[model samples]
Target: MTQVNTFQLNSSKDEAQKAAFQLSAPQDDCAVMFASPHSGRHYPDEFQSLLRVPLMDLRRVEDAFIDQMISPVSELGIGTLSAVFARSYVDLNRSETELDSRMFSDGAPTPAGERSPRVEAGLGCIPRIAASGQDIHVRKLSRDEAEARLQEAYRPYHRALTNWLNLIKRRCGRSVLIDCHSMPSLVAGRRIRTDIIIGTRHGASCDEGLARTVENHFLALGYKVARNIPYAGGYCTQHHGRPLEDRHALQIEINRRLYMDEDTVRLKPGFYKLQSDMKALGLSIMNWAEGTRMLNSQRT
Candidate 1:
């Protein structure tokens, strides 16, 4: 039997258990599903001692508080899925086969498929190190240990996501999986950058119409939004997005500097503003998806 994790969202005499991911609805039938794969913070104590950097610094790569922002999307009548296992523990956006041979003592079998540049950079299914290129541990882990994590953490998250997407598609006859993520405040010290990056794998992951609807929402808010630059989607978007099948996936990357103190990792004064903007955008996207054929539209 598959083990399911039970969490409470509201008052109810009877309890229900979902998988590691969660779903909330307001009884409104919306065809969009929101997902935050790298925003998890449930780090295991056993992995703490292995970290070469401080715990606070270790989380510099994490999409801090993203779960808090997207959690309310459920109340807007859409489904929201979030991973509870920290990205440092196991990244759900990566392919299950993306194991780093160097991270294991006996080495690992290479994954099938074109070797993604991200995996080559040590951000594979089993990352060799955390962000900042800091080594995760002092010694190489056993292959069995790596495989165990794949079975226990990596596989379950994707399995849950797949099942959820399948259900949404069944009900709506079409579904959009917005894979939510947050990027570093500054990468290689670029002074000016995009406020949001909506990646559709350069139009392979989602319909152009859907992408335009999302992109316009941010543009209407007067926030700078870019397409397929710096980020053109990651594993989640690449793996699941299938516009031909009427299931589109888009990767939405919000700049961390907008809502949080990059150094302190705390919500900034503009945090509420950004959240409000997202709320408005979310509503617009939901409404647009309900009545329009976004699959037929294009931004430029």
Candidate 2:
């Protein structure tokens, strides 16, 4: 294990109402950073007042407790960044440019050609609908409202992420971002439910070996692991993953059914076991990073 002091800092409520995200750091930095962009549960009053759907419906979209699942990484001397604002408020994983024009009264800045499939499905940066297809807003929003969310939440989160990754890289010569998420047990018609899915955008986001290492970690735990099936990584994986540049990003999606009561959004009996397994996984990755450092030293 990497030896370092243990420190955790949460934003003051008065400063920004518990910050847009919580950053936990170890005394000595390592090559890995864990991020949970969708696990946020905070719903601001202004955002809640416009909702057409019930709060429970919006909660369905959260990765729910995933941040807590990966919280063990901080104990292993790896840093973690977890969003405080709910994903329904503004998705930190999405590109700021992914705006759905139809949901805004003033029209989106993105051209039709630039709209992604996610946007078409109403899962853009500012979501138009929940994962269950319920319209989120009772009325169309002004462009200013959308922009404000991005300015207040989205950009700052990414800025902090980028800064952390860069600082880690400078200290360790490389950096890896593990973007954590959770998926519903059943996705409409899908029958071959997997316990875990690791996405590297078909090897575009991170080195194939790194992806395989993560896959193997889960497989070793006797869990059914799939690669790039329904999910092949998202914006965070695509945007930040650059293996050639010594910056790698991977997305890990845990089946919500594995650790939480899906309908109630509560922890399952198996939650502790799952968390322990993930902690072991993080330690394995840290060992791999140590080996990489040795290899880089040998080459030099």
Best-matching candidate per lDDT = 2
Tell me how candidate 1 scores on lDDT. 0.75
Tell me each candidate's TM-score. 0.87, 0.92
TM-score of 1: 0.87
Report the poorest 10 consecutive residues by lDDT, candidate 1: 9-18
Model 1 Cα lDDT, one tens digit per residue, 177-199: 88999998677767547899999
Flag regions of model 2 displaced more than 4 Å. Answer: 1-18, 109-113
Stretch of 10 with least lDDT, candidate 2: 3-12
Question: What lDDT does each candidate get?
Answer: 0.75, 0.83
Off by over 4 Å in 1: 1-19, 25-28, 109-114, 293-300
Against the true structure, candidate 2 reaches a TM-score of 0.92
